[model samples]
Target: MTITTDKFNTEKAPKPVGLYPHARKVGNLLFLSGVGPRQAGTTKIPGVDLDEHGKIASYDIEAQCRSVFDNVRTILEASGASWMDLVDVTVFLTNMDDDFAIYNKVYAEYFADNQPCRTTVEINKLPTPIAIELKCIAALSE
Candidate 1:
């Protein structure tokens, strides 16, 4: 059987900062590109404050977590799936020591009912000013 892959792009979520589509589906799975907390239709990073030089002065990880979850949900719904369909998630944080606790708390709240495999790691930075990003995969109805 020939497998087909389809790309997904939606207006309900932030337009990707790069050329990639928001998600892609192959066979029975939907793979999402890394989704950040930037608000849809704008570059505003929720709960983030930048200094006069435009560097990260402070940020709220809880806000970023909630926003990212919402963005992931939006992408999932737009791609014909839901939050519970997510099977795997990979999170990138710019500061693990400072942000993990808050991020974890918010993550628990969002995922209380749907427990998906998750791995979170710290990176030096993201492409934007956001504190976190998520890469996800979901099982789609066959």
Candidate 2:
């Protein structure tokens, strides 16, 4: 059987920093690209303060967590999926030691109802100034 593939991008979500769609579907799985906390239609990143060098000075992981989750939900819905469809999630944090507990706490609030397989790792940095990003996979019910 031929494999069916489709890509999705939504204007309501933050425009991707690179040349890639927000999410892609191959068969029954929907894969989301790294979603960050940057708000749509603006450069403001929630809870991030930039130094004079345009680098991150201080960031509240809790705020980023909520914003990123909202972005992910936006992409999922735009792609005809829902938050409950997420089956696996991979989180990337620039500073795990300082942010893990806060991020985990905020994450629990959003994911209280849906328990998906999750993995979180500390990374050196991301392409943007945000502190966290999420790469997720969802199993569409349809």
Candidate 3:
């Protein structure tokens, strides 16, 4: 069998900050780029508290996690997939110690039944002030 790849873009989710599609489908595997809490066509990020100069003041991990998952769901649906199709997910957090519990709680609300394998890591920063981001992979329907 020959493997084919296709790129996906959707206005239903936040536009990619860099030059990349929201997802790329290679055969049955749909690989999604990192999704954050930013809204489409706006600088606003859910759960993020920004200073007057746009520095991160504080954040709500539950809100950020929910928004990130929502964005991921949009992209997945746009690519003809669903939450149940997700096979793996990688989570990024600016503060694991402060955020993991809330983030995990929010995550369970969405994926407890269709739980995908997940890996979460703490990072110093993200491109925006949001506390969370998610990159995922889904198995496309045959």
Candidate 4:
């Protein structure tokens, strides 16, 4: 495999619906694709498994946000990396004003000391009306 292709592999991150890989690794760097609150294969948010009635059984922003982190972690693990390798991150939110606290709560749990360069922004819309999306870059070990 090419250097970039080997560093980041689509199979590592969540499946992309368009012309995008979950992440791409180039040399010693790993660039993760933007991740939202969706479950592995479905557009539905992670903590909410809807029934046939389309009614959500449970939906917590904190839970959903943590799930997003979990997805990121999965990608990192796939690339033989981890959150400690993260160098930069960008968070996109559909409703930042409403979800900031919940996002922070979940985020702090995962990023407490291994804080990577990060930014957050309020966007007009997200892929699935999920509260947040995260993309990151990580430096691989030599």
Q: What are the Cα lDDT values of the candidates? A: 0.94, 0.94, 0.89, 0.78
Q: Each model's TM-score, in the order given?
A: 0.97, 0.97, 0.95, 0.82
Q: Which pairs clash in the backbone of model 3?
A: none
Tell me each candidate's RMSD, in Å, in order: 0.9, 0.8, 1.1, 3.5
The full ranking of all candidates by lDDT, starting with the best, is 2, 1, 3, 4
lDDT of 1 by residue, 45-108 (tens): 9999999988999998898899999999999999999999999999999999999988999999
lDDT agreement of model 2 with the native: 0.94
Instruction: Give lDDT for model 4.
Output: 0.78
User: So what's the TM-score on candidate 3?
Assistant: 0.95
Error of 1 at 119 (Å): 0.7
Runs of candidate 3 with Cα error greater than 4 angstroms are none
Model 4: CA > 4 A from native: 1-4, 7-13, 47-59
Model 3, span 1-142: residue lDDT tens: 8888999999989999899999999989999999998887788888778899999888777777888889999999998899999999999998888888888888889998898999999999888777888989999777
Model 2 C-alpha lDDT per residue in residues 24-48, reported as the tens digit of each score: 9999999999999999888899999
True-vs-predicted CA distance for residue 7, candidate 1, Å: 0.7
User: Candidate 4 lDDT, tens digit per residue, 1-142?
Assistant: 6453663454434576567777787888888888876777656576665667765554577877888898899888887888899999999976677788888887888899899998999888665546678989999887
